[model samples]
Target: MYNIGIDLGGTNIAVGIVTKEGKVLKKTSVPARAERPFDQIFADMASCIRQLFAETGIKESEIESIGIGTPGCIDTEKGILIFAGNFKYGKNIDYRAEMAKHFDIPVYIGNDANVAALAEVRAGAAKGVKNAIMITLGTGVGGGIIIDGKIFEGAYSAAGELGHIVLISNGEQCSCGRKGCWEAYASVTALVRQTKAAMLANPDSIMNKTPLEQVSGRTAFDAAKKGDKAALAVVDQYQEYITEGLADMINIFSPEVIVVGGGISKEGDYLLNPVREKIKSRVFGIGLLPDRKILPAELGNDAGIIGAAMLHA
Candidate 1:
């Protein structure tokens, strides 16, 4: 039997047909345009599935279930997306119920981070590990926690919000309406802000060559490679903060591995190596590093859809 995975994000809706082994056989993408009517956007999302069905010629009866990874608080028991910051969805949006009008398959919903973690453990970076955590750094921060081989969502499917943890008391305010959140310091958004702040200090910095609006998470790393002191400082500080945050997570879970994903993970070793070393140095207990490790995520963007499809697995 096959499964359908839908990745509903802020700007795009991606639907795919996935096999039990976590491979996507067919997939398509469409604009979500979440600012429009909820039902309308959902219709377009459903249409993508229909288009896939037509192209693949797969009968509805062959599909076992449908899994969705959404960017917000998911009421798993109710299949309701409680809220979505980027998607602008409100509470009580019966997402599964609305989609049910189109197909009769079983539907499972989960937080994007949690679902991504599920995907990793099933077939990606953490495949063989018993316990792992996935941290996705993007416009904001998203995370998933796994313990004893199952997702540890705690209560209300809100347990793995690793980004909102207090990092620096009374420091930068976060989108979650809190101050000193780890997300405020370690996210790509925070990296951009940090790069900009350093650029303002060093007029002759290599980053000045680019428009301020175009400066991205890679700006500091790019300029630092050219031996710019300002850029190097920003990179160092960013890594330091990320190290502390990883240390905090290590203290809490001490999982076999910590998987880092999202746009920033593209940096690969340049990012993961330093953070791992720092975490190794700062975490509780003093001794040589054991089997615990921090590795960059392997699945890339497909993690969302594949993980979503595995919801029923």
Candidate 2:
């Protein structure tokens, strides 16, 4: 049977029809309207689903279940979004219950990061691994851990918060009101912030070519490729911080694989090579290193939808 996957992000909601083998039969996007009322957002999502089915000629009867991947600290059992920094109105939204009532079908809800990890474990980079971790370095760092093919939510259903782990003592400030979080250094937001700070020191750097508002990991990477010494130095510094924190995670969890996700990771070896070198240089247990592969995420943006679909199936 087919499955329906919904990836609800702050900017857009992506819905897909996923086959059992992990192929996407159909997919579409709709504005999340985070600033508007929640009811409107829900209506838009339902409309997107209807439009997708109509365009694809896929009967709802063929679908076995539906799943939603949302950004936040989610109470998976209750299917409620406990808190989300992206969506101001997402607090305590019982999305699964509401969707079930509306569609007359069972619904599963999961954190976006956890859902991506689920996707990787099931069909993507970590496919055959019994233990794995997925880290997405975006606006903020998000992580998920999978052991023996099941999600490892803690007793409070809030485990796998690896990004919040302190990498430095009393260092940079984080959006979560914490100081010295790994995210404060490893996230794309942090990279851009650091780039801008470094740009101020080197006024003639190529980083100045990109407007501050539009500066992203891509811009920084492009500049570094063009022999922009300042940009490359910033990236080196960022990679060092990421390696320091990731070494801790490896020493603690020792997962078989660690899949890196998000826009920065799209740079492939440009990002992965340095991270791997640093992790090996700092962490102990060389045998553990043999089993670990610091791989780029294969599913890209679709991991969330693919994983969310598995939640119900």
Pick the TM-score winner: 1
lDDT against the true structure, per candidate, is 0.87, 0.85
TM-scores of all models?
0.96, 0.93
> Candidate 2 lDDT (Cα, whole model)?
0.85
All candidates: CA RMSD (Å): 1.4, 1.9
Q: Could you give candidate 2's per-residue lDDT for residues 1-313 as a string of tens digits?
A: 7888999888889999998977778999987778887777777777877887899898777778889998778888888878886577658888876675457667888888999999998899889788899999998999999988888998767898889999888989998889999999999999989988877888999889887887777766788889999989998898898888778878888888999999778898999898888778677776554747889899998998899899874
Q: What C-alpha root-mean-square deviation, in Å, does candidate 1 show against the real structure?
A: 1.4
By summed lDDT, which 10 consecutive residues of candidate 2 come out lowest? 283-292
lDDT of 1 by residue, 1-313 (tens): 8999888888788899999999999999998787887888778878898899999998889999899999887788889988886677666788789889888999989888998998898889999788998898888778999887778888898899999999999999999999999999999999999999888888999899988999999999988888999998999899898888888888889888889898888888888787877666687784655846888898887888998899885
